[model samples]
Target: MQFIGPDLKGASPMNPTYIEQLFVKYAKINTRSDPARSATPTTPGQTELAQLIATDLKTLGMSDVQLNPANGYVTARLPSNTARKVSAIGFIAHLDTADFNAENIQPIVHPNYDGQDIRLPGATISVAQFPIFKTLKGQRLITSDGTTLLGVDDKAGIAEIMGAMQYLLAHPEIQHGDVAIGFGPDEEIGKGAKQFDAEQFHTAFAYTLDNGRPGDIEFETFNAAQATITIDGTAVHPGNAYHTLVNAIGIAQQLLNHFPENDVPEQSQNHEGFFLINQISGTVAHAEIDVIIRDFDDAKFEQRKQWLIETIATMNQQLDQPRIQYTLHDQYHNIGTAIATIPEIRELPLKVYRDMGLTPNIVPFRGGTDGNFITQKGIPTPNLFNGGGNYHGPYEFITVEEMVTAAEVVARMIIAHGA
Candidate 1:
């Protein structure tokens, strides 16, 4: 079941090519989730996209299609046509784009590149910044024009999932058991599974098609948490400010100085943990700093948070005035611990990829995903690839061949689970 061409009328817009068609539809919609907002979905655009996807699911003739407004999670059921003894499985993808630059993304569809530095109007998608760009020498690559992200991170996942479902529906002869579909909002900000209703989904296992690079099927991610350091400062007249004023910015900087400079993200990779300061702002009267701690090991992750607490306490001792306060809030944790108990669930993606003539790269995610949250919920969920690269940046790309292949993997996984 191959994607012969673009299903233009069936999709939002008529894409000239299959990859172009998918990118056009997703890029046109603005689905950036706001982290600062207290809303469930975090952005209204996500709900709009959820409604649209629910309608698409209905048109595909899937059953129990419902777009719950509580958290804007779209869920659908595909009852088994065969009497195979298999667990019901689910396919999940997020609807919201990352809070990064995503304005008016113009995707460049180049068919069979000659392996040179592909140049956009304003910038170059060079092989230097991304050496893997050389790996895709002759593949048809779809990339942004160096301004906004391609949104291939999860939209590519959505398109691939939809394409595979369409294939399965068309080919009734393909034996399979119950299949579930789920799409969420605010995944980029770590709240995608916060309000996800597992009961409504009713799946024994699931997979999140959200990863960079093809053939990447992950079962582990970093345990994550955020901490805030607030400082109070007294401002006095310059003439009398010498010894009476407590500069909040200076205190905040001193607290950050406690962490090892080499452990930052720029210098860390491949399972190494780090403490990152995501936001910082201060005035003479007050200051606030937001810190994120990430690690795959629970013990180390805890130690990282404790280090922040101890650093703040140590900083407090240096100041004669009580001008600082700190708070550490746990955000999400690694799914490996939970999934370890469900080893059978972890082997599904690997088997699917192997059956598809692709070797599964079983790697640990330095970041996190909705899969982590679902794993903690007692339903083992891993992640699959959506044929994307350079995520959360303007140079993000997904190949047409890769997208079609990913869809085929989804269909194969469903069929295997049913078998």
Candidate 2:
């Protein structure tokens, strides 16, 4: 299988002219995911971005370029260009940003960054707060204007994958196997991968370009779930209120009290488990509370989920009828357990980094990723870097150097495996 592609001049991993263009083009779209929405994508922008990327994949001469409107996942395949019996591999990235204001996202480019305080219209990237900037001196930096999020969390990953695909397509001299890649929505809220069709996405193993830093690799992620509790009460006039009158709002407050104050999301950090009451709604007659649970340890994660169920049960016993009912949905578990089975998937990226004169930095992510669900399915899916920092906020930024480096890592992994 052969196709003609343009000779991309000055487009190596070190020189990221092609990748930077793709980053800027993707970073401008407003694809902020909504957890509240019941749809798979939860936002129209995600599907729009998927459509654009799908078109680009077709233009790049990829096969099976399908944009699934049902789940907002764009899947494509680049058949093996070599006859060396190379095993097919997969790569994935999300299309949506975090839950923040994402309207008219105008990216600001910093050429030859001076490593100083970067003041934006809505926020400032302080050096004292983020010392990582000091190390990246004289590089091309991309940031938000401060009013809205930069949307670089997964967009950078998307750009890296697309850029690498373009680079691979052009330079057919770099022999590789069949490459399968996908882009989906609602990763921030942790619902995107729930609808992924792993059986359909055939691959021997996969990698997710969702991590941060140049050499970042993550096999362990937070064991995650969400709980929604609803309360029903009898509202009566204050003047005529008696033992018969039950206040649902007061019961909602009591449920909040049952959670540990110090173990909430705001107070917790790396490796610590927490129960977060993300959304609360109440009235005298009806009330509801939404909570998300997280822990890296499997046993401890179960304990957290059990505690919620037991607390709700105890509260129900005190009521005349079981007025409190809740639903718990497990989002994803740690990929470490799954990735451990296939050692090659984990070692491939590390070898690539070491060969590139970079050290492999293994991180236990505090949050979940699309890889969690995919890894749990069957094929081992480890995570690689997206080359960005300060994710899910206004201070978010991505560097052209690291973005291209990440793409190179992806390409090299294929060459190493295929060879």
Q: What TM-score would each prediction reach against the true structure?
A: 0.86, 0.86
> How many residue pairs clash in each candidate at the backbone level?
0, 0
lDDT of 2 by residue, 335-365 (tens): 8887888788877888888877778898888
- Model 1: which residue pairs collide? none
TM for candidate 2 is 0.86
Off by over 4 Å in 2: 1-15, 35-44, 119-124, 237-243, 249-254, 318-321
Error of 1 at 294 (Å): 1.2
Which candidate's lDDT is highest? 2
Clashes of 1: 0
**Residue runs of model 1 more than 4 Å from their true location after superposition:** 1-23, 36-40, 100-108, 117-124, 127-131, 145-147, 241-243
